[model samples]
Target chain A: MTEEIIIAGFGGQGVLSMGKILAYSGIMQDEEVSWMPSYGPEMRGGTANVMVILSSERISSPYLKVFDTAIILNQQSLDKFQDSVKPGGVLLYDPNGITIHPTRTDIEIFQIEGNKLAVDMGNAKISNMIVLGAFLKIKPIVKLDNVIAGLKKSLPDRYHHLIPLNREAITKGMNNLKPFLVAEMILK
Target chain B: MAELKLMKGNEALAEATIRAGADAYFGYPITPQTEVIEYLMEQQPEKRTGMIVLQAESELAAINMVYGAASTGKKVMTSSSSPGISLKQEGISYMAGAELPGVIVNVVRGGPGLGTIQPSQADYFQSVKGGGHGDYKLYVLAPASVQEMSDFVEDAFDIAFKYRAPVLILSDGIIGQMMEKVYLKDQKPRMTNDEIIEKYGNWATTGKKGRERNIITSLDLQSEKMEKRVHRLMKKYKQMEAEDLRFEKIACDDADYLIVAYGSSARISQKAVELARKKGIKVGLLRPITLFPFPKKALFDLANQVKGILSVELNAGQMVEDVRLSVEHKVPVEHFGRTGGIIHTPEEILEALEQKIINNGSIRHHKTRESSIL
Candidate 1:
């Protein structure tokens, strides 16, 4: 199985790190993974993004036009990627700073309350982890244990103390996911 | 045994340099490619393997430093993006003329002047067609993956030292910034002074022990002597073209149309090949792994079979000229590319191949399009 994903948000929101951890998790499962981030001056604050491909086979191209899953964290990211999701693909997002919601009906739109969960966890930095948790719940692309292990491995030793909290935030994030259903489509 | 680890292409190249026993890295910081030096500084191979990592104040200083280090017959290296690489071309030409061995990693960004710090293969002409002064060629290797990014460090050094010439790891910002699984090579110890003298004492600046001083210079007032040196360099390039030319043929067997690309464009073109074949177009991909020793013979042979040929790149039809020259206009040669740091999608490539090459095969001539659409 191959899953092409884009996780996009503000520069300091750990968007690239989240993708890196997910890619590392894929490696732990003996899969091929590639993580490509939007770098340069814009990455400092102007809506950073990363393209991650986890494949059981060889990955072809790091630059992907359509994503099987788009983990949009802010209104800007959602607006940029809502229509770019593939048909029957999943669109996971954080309802933290979002104003306009996704408009697509062909793809499943799932929202994780990352900001509230991170606040509950008493660590604002784990917001991306929560969104990752919601992504795992939908795809199960990698196991929960592997994801936790991957989070620990991806972080440096100095930041090791935050792993447990991040793990908990991911679980909370998985539980808080709100699936945009047919009712919402009919309402629209 | 080297373990498989996940790494960005830039970091992987740094680690590879350490493992390859690179004697020194003299480089300047550049966007989209700065991670090479950053990783080297962080790893501190000087402590681990006695390799040197020095950040020069400018690209000019860096390549000159590399030249100085390489004169001692050590495995020296330098890395920079497109514009910085342009500054290093003089030093590279010096290294080539002096017949010193070194590796220069060009993690290419968009170019012309101070272009954007995004991935682009616009440096194809500068890299493969000799950006530096004088008629010289660098053994240009293009890596499409993080593993190759790391692995080619060793290959570059091996080829560089073997022929006493410079080798270039001609990569782009896409491969430089991307992260993927890489199986690192086992660490090689840097050569000792005694070993260096043994291997290259004939020409290396090894204190001139037990013999008259061996002077290294790129100058010869006599046109006859200079002509001989130029011929020698050309001969070496001919040998490399004959023996070291490398390419990857992707599903070319029984195909009617061929898409030639390198680096990131090659990877994307592979996806385009799959999409085109799915739509009943018999297309395959030809990936040039070594850009300088360019697989012209292979391209010519393939041109005889394929009904049409399309060269895809992140620049405006640079390698397409080489492709056109390779087949000698036997088959229709066309180029589809996006420049100024823009990358083309597989669907766009497929559409171009279908509309511009495969379906329009009767137009038995060369054509090109500047990518204006997103």
Candidate 2:
């Protein structure tokens, strides 16, 4: 199985790192993976996106137009990538700064209070991990153990102490994800 | 055992240089390729293997430094984006003319002038057909993946020293910026100065003790001697073409439509070929790994089997001309591309194949188009 995922948000939101962690996890499981990012000026302060692919077979295109899952963090990303999700695919987002939510009917839309959970955990940096946890809850493409191993591999040794907190954030995100009722929101 | 690590292509290439036992890396940082220098700086290969990494003030300085280091029979390299690469053309020409061995990497971006920081293959003509002045050729290798990006460093150096010619690693921002799992080979120890003198002593200026002094210069005022030098260079190029042409064919045996591409474009076209095959369109992909000794003979041979060929690139249409020339108007040849950093999608490629080759079965030759334009 091949999983093409796009993770988009502000540069500081750990968008690129989240994708890196997922890719590392794929590697831990002995799977082929590729991570291509929208680099340059946008990576400084503006929106940043990374295309992460995990495949049982060889991955063809590193840059993709459509995705099996889109883990969007900000409103701008939601606007840009909502239509890019494949039909029956998953669109997981953090209900933080998003004003315009995804309105897709064919795909599954799930929202996790990633920002709030991260703040409550005393580190807003773990917000991406929360969203990643919610993604795992929806589709466990990679094992949790591998993700923890991935965290160890991706994070520098100095940040090793915070792995438990990040792990906690992931668990919190997994439990708190709520399916968004698009029709009800439209009616309101 | 080889160490397996997940690394960005640029980072992987940088680390490979150290493992390849390179003597020095001199480069000015540029977007999409700066990570190469950054990784090298962070790794501090000087501590581990005594490999020197210096940030030159400019691309010109970096390339000249490569020239100086290479002249001493040292393994030297420099990398840059499209515009910066353009700046180093004069130095590159000097290296080529002087028959100095070095590796020059161009992590190509959209261009004519500082076009975009995003990936592009627009430098095809510039790279394959001599970017610098003179009739010299740089052995060009276009790596399609991160693994190739890492692996080609040693390969480039080997070819460079073997032929005493510069080798170009023609990459793009996509390959440079993307991350993938790469198995890095074990570290090889750098050759000692004595070893260098022993190996390249005849040609290299390792100081004159008992032997005649070696002079390194591209200048020969006598026109007859200059022509002979150029002829000798041409012979080396011809030798490279005959011996070192490398390419890959994907599902070409039963294919009716063919796609010829290299570097990042080739990687994307691989997907397009798969997509077309899924839709019952018999398509194949020919990826040229060596751009200078470009898979001309391969394309010429494949032309006989395939009904039509489409050259895909990030440029408007550059390699298509080469494809057309190789096939000798054997069948219809078309170019489908996106410019200024826009990478074409697989679906769009399939659509182009359908419209340009499958449905519109016309044997449109380059000469005809050129004459028509004239």
* Tens-digit per-residue lDDT, B1-374, candidate 1: 77888898999999999999888999999988999999999999999999999999999999999888888788999999998999999999999998999999999998789989888999989988888999899999999999999989999998998799999999998999999999998989899878876775567887877978876678888999999999999999999988898899999998999999999999999989888888888898999999989888899999878888999999988999999999987788889999888889998999898888877836543333212221
| Candidate 2: stretches off by over 4 Å | B197-201, B361-374
Native contact share for candidate 2: 0.81
Q: Compared with the true structure, what per-residue lDDT tens digits does model 1 show for residues A138-166? A: 99989988887787777789988878787
Worst 10 residues of 2 chain B by lDDT: B361-370
Over the stretch A83-142, how does candidate 2's per-residue lDDT look in tens digits?
Answer: 999999999998898888778899999999999988898888889999999999998989
What is the C-alpha lDDT profile of model 2 across B1-374, one tens digit per residue? 99999999999999999999999999999998999999999999999999999999999999999999988889999999999999999999999999999999999998889899988999999998888999898899999999999999999998998899999999999999999999999999998868766665568776778878888888989999999999999999999999988999999999988999888888888999998988899999999999889888889999889878999999999999999999897778999999988889887888898999888735445436646878
DockQ-derived CAPRI band for the predicted complex in model 1: high
